[model samples]
Target: MEQTQGMADETRHPMTGNRLDAEAEASGPGFETHDYDVVVIGAGGAGLRAAIAAHDAGARVAIVCKSLLGKAHTVMAEGGAAAAMGNLWPDDNWKVHFRDTMRGGKMLNNWRMAQVHAQEAPDRVLELEEWGALFDRTPDGLISQRDFGGHRYARLAHVGDRTGLEMIRTLQQRAVALGIDVFMEFTVTELCKADDRIVGAVGYWRETGRFVVFNAPSVVLATGGIGRSFQVTSNSWEYTGDGHALAMRAGASLINMEFVQFHPTGMVWPMSVRGLLVTESVRGDGGILKNSDGERFMFNYIPDFFKAETADSVEEADGWYEDKKNNRRPPELLPRDEVARAINSEVKAGRGTEHGGVYLDIASRRDPEFIRRRLPSMYHQFKELAGVDITQEAMEIGPTCHYVMGGVEVDPDTQQSSVDGLYAAGEVSGGMHGSNRLGGNSLSDLLVFGRRAGECAAENAAKHSNERAAVPDSTATAAADAALAPFAEEGGENPYTIQKDLQDVMHRLVGIIRKREELVTSLTELEELKARAEHLSVEGNRQYNPGWHLAIDLANMLIVSECVATAALEREESRGGHTREDFPMASDEWAQINLVLTYDGESVGLARQPLPVMPDDLKELFD
Candidate 1:
């Protein structure tokens, strides 16, 4: 791997002028070693932000990612970042945004995190602008705000539909300008620990198959989500629950694992591209959902929870788009969980389109130029991928596995996990979005919490400035053996086959709608898959081998899938993303509880913890 100019040489530890590991040096040609104050994994929007924060805080930071620097899953985030800037509507503020977030999450969110995110998101968005992010501007030259599902106003600050790309570009440029060391094309397989605290990480280079170790006082996990565990997903190959599994194995607890968000509109035609995302921006810009008979089905499915705020008729709903003060929101703008279930119900009742999905039509509502100007990427995505001209015809869409609301449980303020020195942020950390995340809160969550994680990690490292944790030779050797074990097996289960089976189990059993029997069956199937994965074998040497990578990633996928299914089985009530068909309605008791998962080396264990109570002042907003 190439290091930036001015970076410390890898031959010795930066903090101490000594060889990184004496034992490893004696047993030569095994792995390379480096040292840093803070190591951030994933290199997405969150990782970059965390690295920048740590670097600016006078810490030597290194970012290790499975892919190239800027090709993170954040680039695929088409909708904007949610922040209460109030540029479009003067009534919008942090309180309103916080209330909307908590309501959208079905009151199962970490109230403190929700409050902090809302209060800081505006400042974070403004900071991005100051960092050279060119957001779409309003007529008065303010950053443009757009409407999204579950939000009370036009609050998403965007750059057309490619807001995430711009945010990443800005963060990445800032990190590079700060000269933070980046380890590209590196996959971290294990988090090395000493005295039950994070000390370093170990992983292999994708190009040369050589293992490397980073000895650091603090490590930040921004490794996104577990979407790749499912069959139909918007997440990339890198989202194999690396951070979630790593934290779990490192003796940290994960919260709300059952709450997996199925985005309402994914392309559902041409089997090869069935799960590709059709961004929520389509609906934000006046698109509507229709079933086979061309009925606006979202109208019939508006739940009582949002009845007071949602419009009943088409006229009022349509009018609300242009004049927000006088009219209520349309049912189509309900939270993702609500809309996905509605679409699922429609398909089950035989009202679906020819492709077994519903239609998302904007062609009949807006002008072609308006559509192109607003959703340029979507226009091209449909045209190039499905041969469908979105400006002229409707696009078939269905629910696709999107985001996970569950992740490494952390302190809401510091973003520190249960394990000391092991911090998490972005989609990898839990409790920020609660049971369900709104359309655009992810980008903002990454920035706000990523910065917190980095700054806190830097401070944590500073406390141990005189001390350093060495990567124990035994631990590093064990990790290397486990990583290379797949290549040694002969005539064993194919890693690809096991992964496909695992995805099928998760997609069919523990998917958008779940039941007790299906969830239990999924758990049993997972155990069997886990057994098969133990004997997983690959045909290639590890030099840039995708099969070997998948083989290694399968362990993380199984661990995370088991966490999801186990938590889903325990959370009997229907709430947000974790829908239980057996226990159909949302229960007050369940609402008060958050499912937490832990790993004890071999198996995952679950526990129920009470949700943090909201303060009287914040509760007053809801009342």
Candidate 2:
């Protein structure tokens, strides 16, 4: 770990005092204000990386997170970060990674962003290594890469199954060492704009619910996915689409809002941990998917898109695990969208476990020691949560909402959103993954785009710092009033009940398999939810009030759910993560179209835009 800067020399704010855990109470009025060159909202991989990059570029940066540092959602990521280091497969390179990404998204991905991610991911992984991240190593002393869906070869640098933990730790250590100001457990409610440009943000402390202002020329929204909108999800409560809502409300366009990736293997038997993740590493490490009859089911569901590379026969699939050079990759390791659809089909066909899920069996395929060694967290998670030892028995797994493939539309070159001075990265920024994101790519996307977002945000801040030294009090006051509106409502629906109903609506109507009628119904239901949310009333005071927080988060979830439903209704193709049972096949016309959602002051509107054309050199890879 790097040494932390002493308190004597570090930047200090009156609101924070000299201590790290500073607190102030404000119930009715008045709020503290602070200023920074750049404010990064979120403390996950993307936010941490962005803050670190901004600080390193000679900018005063701060990170605002809803949870304590190190407790961000990134720590829950079990599989490795995808980077084409080619340690195991010497022939693998960026072109192959890029090709796989575009193909995995069914060619709906932003070509330039895909190219950039493929080209820059290797260096980002190496940089993490330099910052004291020790990845699994090969016999040759290079970082050992592992197989993952969509990638052509062994190309993920991991630390067992706790790769995200290691990554967040390294980035957190580096950020703390650099003395970047972090307001832990701070939930940003609104992005405050002055002079028609983003100059700061208004949010309340999660501990006290006291509104605070972070004045900066630039803001980076790295707050993650909208998973909590769905009933079954691998997302934490904090993943309620705060960043997406903030950006949309601040006048930025969101792309691909309809595409939500339902990870194939989530714990289903134990009702309490139903949405908990079962890492893709299981399949990458030679696990097989089966139905209740013990039939290898994934083999029968291989789509034509993956037929060339995916093995059809059990012999070839099993052989590929041992010898990748001579045999094809297993169909079980297909991209997340395909695998999830297959699993959903199995369960709906009555070929599922008692809990309405298919079986993920690695126990019968691999030795117990190997299972325990490679997947320690998963081994313990199943053993403790489900009372089933994964080393001895199969895990009952089903699709759960994992990630969003759509978010704030940004320029691929600079990571700048449609709204000036506002930037986004990670799952909050769209166009990289298209209609679906492959496993392992999420981490790499964070690193590659987070760095760019930070660098570009810093440049913008430096250029505009002289003009944006202070945010007007009118803007801050309005933001605070809006945030506290829930407290004023006397009789209204409970925020939690509203949230739960919204989740039910999303899961039932706009789920893994979407239909036009269902999507339309979801949109209408979401409008009703939004109306209820507008008058939501909490029972408790603002001090450490979870009810107030939920009320605020509910508003954001409603906004994001509206985007998902609207975009899903507009796009009529079954492609990648946005599977339309009504339009049950990938359409060439829709392939060329990308849905763009904009908050046009009064209402959110959708527009159809053409996909970015790939350059000849990059397009040659597919040919």
Candidate 2 on 377-450: residue-level lDDT in tens?
99999999889998999999999999999999999989999888999999999999988898899999999999
Clashing pairs in 2: none
lDDT of 1 by residue, 1-623 (tens): 22222335335434322233323323333777888999999899999999999999999999999988899999999889999999999999999999989988999999999999999999999999999999999999999999999998999999888998998899999998998888888899999999988889989777657688889989999999999999999889899999999999999999999999999999998998988999999999989999999888887776766655435334544533322333467678889999999999999999999988999999998999999999999999999999999999999999999999999999999999999899999999999888899999999999999999999999999998898877888898889899989888999999899989999999899999999889889999999999999998888666668999999999999999999999999998999998988899999888899999999988999999999988898899976
Instruction: Tell me the TM-score of each prediction against the true structure.
Output: 0.94, 0.94
Worst 10 residues of 1 by lDDT: 16-25
RMSD of each: 4.4, 4.3
Model 2 residue 338 CA deviation in Å: 0.8
